[model samples]
Target chain A: MTSTETTPFREAPIQPGDLLLSIENLHACVEENEILRGVSLQIRAGEIHALMGRNGSGKSTLSKVVAGHPAYTVTAGSIHYRGQDLLGLAPEDRARSGVFLGFQYPVEIPGVSNLEFLRVSCNARRQHRGQEELDTFAFEDHVRETMAIVQMDPAFLERSVNEGFSGGEKKRNEVLQMALLEPLVAILDETDSGLDIDALRIVANGVKKLALPTTATLLITHYQRLLDAITPDFVHVMAAGRILRTGDKDLAMALEQRGYDWIEEADGSDTLQP
Target chain B: MSNVTQSRPRLWLETLLQVLAQWSGGGAAGQPAGARDWGLPTRRSEAWRFTDLRCLTQLDPTRLHTGTAAPHWPEAFRQAPSGQVSPRRLSLQLDGRGHWLSPQGEPPPWPHGLMPLPTGDIAPGQVLRTVIPSGTLLPLGAQLNGVTPGPSLGLQVSGPDPVHLDLAIQAEHAQAWLAPHVLLVLQPGARLCLNWHVAATAQAAVLPMVEARLGLGAQLEEATMAWGCPGAAFLGGSFIHQSPRSVYRRTNATWGWGLSRDEPFVRQSQGQAETHLHGLAVARGQSLLDTHSTVYFDGPAGRLRQRHQALADDRGHSVFNGRVVVPRVAQQTDASQLSRNLLLSTKARIDTKPQLEIVADDVQCTHGATVSCLQADELFYLQSRGIGRDQASRLLQRGFCEEILQRLPQSALLWPSLQSLLETPVPDQP
Candidate 1:
């Protein structure tokens, strides 16, 4: 239950011709501190990229910044999703554009039932896409089925969103939301944190099932164990808010055994450019 | 009936003096004659700190000389008197002094030992006397109505079986000052469920009070709602006296009154009593709503849980004051009071205070007050899910109010207009 056999989730050639998200020379700040400095990455349709970084390496901030979080001001950067200026769009617009970021710590909304929130949220997305909104009963069946993908209990749907939920349950709930939203570019931030073996399996498998050939996935984690469950086509190591190296899945296993010192030394040896 | 009656004879306007003196019945024993000698409430009055009497006086300047007028039913009330005009289901309408009737023009089937009679036959009982006391505006308004010979109705309950009553109060025109009072006496082991809907449409002043006494081992569940718009002013209060082994539960909701206040006072006589009070006030436009509740534990082993919530937008103002008193004899008392408020607009204001006075050595009393605007992060959380900023705020606001609304009686929850109360768009927080 600890790890799955490394069956490369994306063995076909990466669809570089259909770029979905591209980050070039990105820099972001929260309040007084600069968090994401000169971070650049690109993803194409039908590709899965695993981002491995140490604590405080700015992985979470990069995820939030790309999601158009207002709190994280992109001082000097450019994010393009589907060939459009993503940073210029409002957070909600980005969501409707099919980009979803699974938070490391989902907020607790007291007195708001999970079912109602999800239904309203889905309706908003559907309306944005020029589709008819789903009513309560119709949305209930869809949400119930989606919850099963994450192995969530039906009773959790009746409770407040993330309120009083265990850490693992909250993670699984986030996965359920991702499955329901059906985002084109999904960024899973620390989805492996605070999860048991069974929960990890359910969440990883849920992500794998929801990802379509036209959609891309970004898996951000500190450990390579999650990579085993959902093998990525490419693994990128990040430090000081910038990705220092990129390789195949073995890079994740190598970083686990060799630690981050070798990557730091290698990055210092080269003249890094945005 | 044991309301406020202590007066110090301070020189005041004749209108204030006449109203207080007549209402206090020439100063009852232990009643605060200050109720009379004291002039009309200003911001200086502790109980009236959050409300302005000028607003009420402005509604009817010559109220002192005019007195209560004859019950002139409005066209709206005279019709089939449908729910829109007074939409509460299973309702009894109070047309005038000492008169009560069902919207369908009949009375409810009262359980075994309870009977309904004219207001004249029912001498107002003194149980909730300590709750409202004779000295407040409630007694003054009631006494003013007594001046006019009008119709009134009273319901008497004496059986051990459960009794249920659904009633409503509708005030007359804007020029006349209206005051209506009702009494309920529960016998030992009796159970009573009473729901009241109070509405005033015209530009008049109103003071409505309900006084109830719970006998030993008796249980009572009561829910009352008072709503109005720019033209009306209402001062609603409830007083209760609970005997040992008795329990009292009350839920009060107010919305859109020009100036209104909901006050509750309850006292446990011999301990072992339980009391639950839940209040919600939603105000918009230039409305002002305030709620002040005080619960006292007199004997040993009493318990209380009280919560008050306010949601204000536009240029509205809301106030909440919850006070819990535990005397030395009331050992092993458990009490908690929380006042949660949401200021939804730049001009919206909220004043919340939770006061606890415990003289008992062995008691658990906790009180807290919170006034907050919706967090930016919370809004972003919803907006990030594709909901617009405005829609996201509405969801959060509805969720904030759902805590108490979910606990209200089914009939009140189903009130046709209640949905709009939660649906109104809130201005973004400044």
Candidate 2:
């Protein structure tokens, strides 16, 4: 099996300043079971794009396929990031190239401290970019600065990587990593899931402060409440592995009021596109 | 008939005879029928199913011994009592080879109600025997020095009072075999803390046997760490018997050596007895480390818990076997065993097995084993923060060893020694 996929389609010449990621005709599956069929979306640099969908609507599968998750097979797709063929790179290579995926449920790695974990990840990226390695002092300083953005206590730095963190704390830790890595394209998978109001605000604010003109973010969520805190430049409604509608922030409110039932009837079809 | 009798015997049968002779003191003493009848293990034996002894039996046992004299107490250990900084010590040495105790010194009296081990079967060739008086609370410290090998030492302590014992053994650049036997008896309400640190040269080997008996209401805490030479071999065995209302805690750690193995056996003989065992092993290069522990509940209302963790790198190999057995009479017994391993290189290998044999219907017994590589996400997280992959792995390993290290007593002298082991190029001192 080849490690990467290549698409022949090219977007209209990039407007000197435009979105960082554009996906077209994306079809993905696992073991021949199609999950995401013909999904298309766009996100401009410095913009947060919220993707809303119900359970079993292929929200997570789309993100996984985009991140090059080994389990998902991309049947047909074209993913261009910064004028590069994203589907042609390994997951780690994608990460080194500034693509990051914040897992919905962070994995727990026992016996590996948060500090050490972050240091190694940062060093990998630095090495990939052919930059000088940061010494202990410089690395510690970096950790301190990034952790501040998330309002995380410095003491947690020594603890094992998410070994026993509470739900909200785990979400905040994910953001902490994203802040430290400074990814060009970050797919935040359910970042607001399992958070108390206080924790939600802290995490949302961290994301807001970290966003820059050179970076873009894909915010996947089930509820619109998170959008109230971190407004998205554009909102997309996904149903059954495909984008049903795309519009400004008003689309999220309309969906919240109409409850996806309207989209089901408007399509006039019970079966989803595959 | 003479010619036929002189013909070479079957290799398998000869091996059995050799093992029997060794156990029976070369046949000077009549071999016990039961011991002889046990016979060598075949594929049928459950315990030996995964391990092959054929290759081990082929090696010449005599060649395994290092004949060098033990070295003198390193300047560091000599001044350890004064808290002076010293280089690490070896686990095996030649000079202080035989069983010899330091000059007798006045020791404090032990608390009341402690029972000491009664003098019993002295091994035929025991070289030295030291006895601690009953109810004596003594702080016993000893440093075994030199490169010469072939010394056997034994100790028996009996009392109702609490006792603290500190021991260090060092060996450098010499081949030798040292065996030490320790026996402890704690009367009702007695307590003890025992610490052992061993360091060996590239050609040293150490074998130690420790046995303890805890009386009703007695408690014992023991910790041991071994850092051996590139070619050193260490073999250790511990057996503990607990009575009602007794508690026992044991923790052991080891850095890579040529070859090292630890075996601990615990038996709870009465109700309301508890035992806890925690161990860590870190191996690098071509070193091999193995640990096996068994907990048996022969009485009702007993509880046992054990945790074993290992890290292997650079073609290293680690093996762990843990078993918990509860008999029919041992009702209300609760037991658990967990073994986790981290492999740093694709060539590193770990074999872990956790087994449970329970006959009681109302008992709770659980066992688990896991072997995995470092998490990719975790590693990336550290690398992104400027720590190289190698340093990141080392940090993670140190964290893995920390849980067991926290249980050790406060000794500034020991921390540096442990730290050096965690880093590359294992230090020479203990």
Candidate 3:
């Protein structure tokens, strides 16, 4: 309910009911190379799950699969979000249904201003909930407020979306959108990869601020530093296209202190029980 | 000759001969020499090659309404924000035959140094025809201006002194044909801002011919928007002649009509003149739009920058042909042109040709054109934030057209109206 909800940090495996997302034996690929192989996970309403894996371990693939990236094909899997088949819906439909993805490499759209984009997106979300759309004046105020969470410069609002922006600025822009949309499930796919120390703190703080009791987050990252900034309830180590082990935040520290080799050696997963 | 029904090309030749006859003052007694004749364009002619006028053949010219009644100009043209170099507007309306209507109340006092050329009518700004030069044997749409039979009045701003002149043209009449000629002459050091808002309301045809001559050190900044109602068509040619040290900049856009063709020609006869042009042509709903522009440098040390954009959705088709010529005598000339086209639907089409003809060894010229659809990733990016695909497309479309819209002077910016127009749905397919 608060920014410091990770306090009294409990080590609990995912539970049933109040289930925000359920991925059962998800298998996906791009071209002919299979990236996600029989990956299964579940996230509750008030949970922050961290997915860590080695290069080509399918952490990013799982995030994209959930976001409905057109590039990846699901050979066999069922993704249920809010009790509906998420895979049957288009990416935009998935988004309108309260799903958000903070891309690992956020796209640059030239000529579309950041402010205009935010207003359009926010108004769309509002309209879906049967609320009236905000005029330019009202939208400007709303966006200016949200932009402060990411410490984004107001001038960036006039600039083209992510065009000519630094890596830190793009990440901040992603968090800014997250704050504006306030989605039910937010996937930060390698959002910390190119960010510096200052940017990482601001982004992590913004995410922490936006997390609500009814909202869930999935952070796909390789470092334990991001976990240290915004503590996760569950940390899963993935290897060879499948999540090998699931544990508390200590798992991230363990994977960082040692390596993913230990998680791979401890084979035949689905070890953690509710 | 009046009873003859000739082929379209033959008719154009006949019209040109008649114009020559009129210039020689050889018209029959009791007949006006300046009877504007609009010859329909056809595929055989070079100027009308890309734009087909076969559609006009079905409409009977004899049945055209030459109604003397004037229209109540809509509020679109009256939107000029206060306080930044204010200038007077010239309210003029013309019939299909290039004739201005009877006195529509007292006209605005002509700005100093702008003398109206002799015409049968006493109105101001209604006679839009520019006098096409009979001097050159070069190919001419000069006949288009010559054929519009109207009370001829020319507005010329001369430059033995400096003058700040603003001219605006807008149409609102229904079911009338328009063949008007507009002429402007700016002397050295003279400055002019011209705006043309051409609209053909419902089943009307508007063909305008504008000719402008700029002396040394003269400057002209012009903005134009050509739009029309269903079944309305507009076709025209604009010729600009510049002397040494003259500067010309124009920003033009077409929201589009059923059949529209705009031909603009710029000739830099003397050295040191600068030419800049920005254009947007949007076609939708079975509309056909073609813009052919040529900028020629006759003397050395001239510069030019030209950018044109086209957007077509549904069964709409848009064509752009831009040519820049730098001759042997025009050494040290610098010219660059770009054409950007956007097609929103599988059925929409765009044909663009950006060319540079450089003969001088010391000249520099470059041209490029690109056709692209809205990126799916970009669309997904906007939608991920909860924006609909349609709204996101409109935002991107506005963003695309703004590149040219930004070139308009701050004093002439029509913000609210343009903003509302951009927000309106753009028909993606017929």
Candidate 4:
């Protein structure tokens, strides 16, 4: 009944064969502008991975590429989701295969009820897994249960999807969706951007409660404050579209103390024809 | 000119002409003096631009027949009048094969401002008169079946008591033309609610003309719903005249049809008159639907508000032309018009025009028209929730029609029929 040993700063390296997601030298561009240049990272199951980077460091583009967004084209490199090649799948197919992206800016849809939409999305995943579709009552029960986990009001389900929703409410709704979908690999792409301190804690706690032994999470954020709430097993510093340095939780503390300029300086000396 | 002569006149046109000729030979019992001057469709007319008259000329004049037997009316229409709250009074049911009228009530007094339908070579001046006594609430209902090439009903109503007229018309294979000369003369403080339904089958064609005149201080609430089959064609015209201090509200809802057109003309002749017109038209497959409405402010201190919405899918097309005119005499006239269209398919098209002509210096008039496709974000949102793209589109389209459908009087009963027409796969029919 004893809890596992807690690491205050440093943690051991992830053993081989524990990888849940592997992005190999990924190169992606949006339209004519190249955003991601040879980025690579590995996320292990039962562990939280923190991706910290400055603005315009291709953090968002890499998440979009992994989610199979239509706007970002992957010219090279490969993404493996649970050892399955993710590049050949459509965005929706990728979602059906247990890949979830909590969008930074969720789209607003008027005249479409939130309950009706969630039921359909849940059923799609079930259908993809060869399971029977849940009837109305079962679907409503599932939504209510998930709404509780995210601390969202039940009335939000009756309103149009994300229509006229406040910033915190939309972020909470995205987490609620993640809870309901229960994806094996979830990528939170700047979801903490507009959330207040209280909303940020609720969202982080929701993710922490939903994480399973076989589930892996990639928390992409600009600030290390989110990592403080949901401490990651591995922390990676990304600059200029590549992983400049990888360490345990202490690297995040170091970066928080010195800012991204120190990481750029360290990477600059390492790659200077040595 | 050569094309006009070579093209056959419309079958309805030929039937009208033959009926007019027969009535003229019978010494014009109900004919007006200026009948000959009423113009017929020609190549030069703006209304006849998209309609081809050549196929109509091929119809033989000898095919026209007259009989005392009435066409069979559907059971749905026969049972509709029983639901009316008012007492049964003068009622005319034209089943196409024969005519029936309840003999319990006396004729209503004719209103002073009654205007007859303009007669041409095809249509003779004829009027069906029904009179209900003052201080009595009368419920009138009629069912017209247009299965044959020549069948029509002309009805006029006048009385001081409040009246409710429920008219339902169904046309089958052959073409039919109905000119209902409704001249309702409401006394001071009188009120009326008129409900009319016109539906045509795939092979039928129908033309319904409804005209009403309101007295001073009167109020009228009118609602009309028209639907046509894949190959059917429909032409509907409604003319309303408002007296001093009278108020009128009219709503028209249409869906389905091969080709359907509705023209509503409203004129306010005295001060403090108010009128409102709202309509919705939905077309699927290769069907074509159009609405033309005009509101005229000929009196001072008049007000008019009009709004029209259209949704076109598949290869369907919709056209809307709304005009609000304020004359120099209409010193304090206020008018507004808006037309909004949603095109679902790449091939679906909509043409909307909102025109405002104001000659009065102290009048306010405004008009706007917009055509757009379904929002991509909205579609994605629905898809993200679990509904397929097709089902999401249908739901959104139905929401678009809900505004105008709310205005229909019998939407409770008519909604199912309209939904079926919308959901049913478009049949390949010519």
Best by TM-score: 1
Off by over 4 Å in 2: A1-18, A126-134, A264-274, B1-45, B53-96, B99-175, B186-205, B215-218, B226-233, B253-261, B280-291, B309-321, B339-362, B369-430
Candidate number that wins on DockQ, 3 or 4: 3
Superposed by TM-score, candidate 3 places the C-alpha of residue A63 at a distance from the truth, in angstroms, of 2.9
Cα misplacement distance, residue A125 of candidate 2 (Å): 3.3
Counting clashing residue pairs in each candidate, in order, gives 23, 69, 16, 23
> RMSDs, each prediction?
7.7, 8.5, 6.9, 10.1
Model 3: fraction of native contacts: 0.48
- Winner of 1 and 4 under lDDT: 1
lDDT of 1 at A117: 83
Per-model TM-score, in order, reads: 0.85, 0.74, 0.81, 0.71
The Cα error of candidate 2 at residue A193, in Å, is 0.7
- The alpha-carbon lDDT assigned to residue B329 of candidate 3 equals 95
Docking quality tier of model 4? incorrect
* lDDT, residue B233, candidate 4: 64
- When summed lDDT is taken over every stretch of 10 residues in candidate 3 chain B, the lowest stretch is B124-133
Task: Please give the DockQ score of every candidate, comma-separated.
Answer: 0.31, 0.16, 0.32, 0.14
lDDT of 2 by residue, B80-134 (tens): 4322222221122223434433212112122233222335544411211221222
Report the lDDT tens digits of candidate 4 across residue range A1-274: 1111211222223343477788999998889988888987877778778888898888878887887665788888999977778887656666665778888888776545677667767766666555566777999998998898879999999887788899989989989888877777889888888989999999889989987777888888878888889888877777888878778788789888889888787784442110
Candidate closest to the true structure, highest DockQ:
3
Per-model fnat list = 0.51, 0.23, 0.48, 0.16
User: Considering TM-score, which of the candidate structures 3 and 4 is the better prediction for this target?
Assistant: 3
Could you give candidate 1's per-residue lDDT for residues B1-430 as a string of tens digits?
A: 1224522222223444455444446522323334434345567767667776555666534353223332223334335343223222234566544356556555544445566644564366345455554644553333333333333345566666666566666654665555566677777887877777666667766676667778899988888767776777877767788999999999877886898877778889778999999988887898899888888888999999998889899989998888888889999999988888999899998988888888999998888888889978778787777766767778888888777777777766655556556766332211
lDDT of each: 0.74, 0.66, 0.71, 0.65
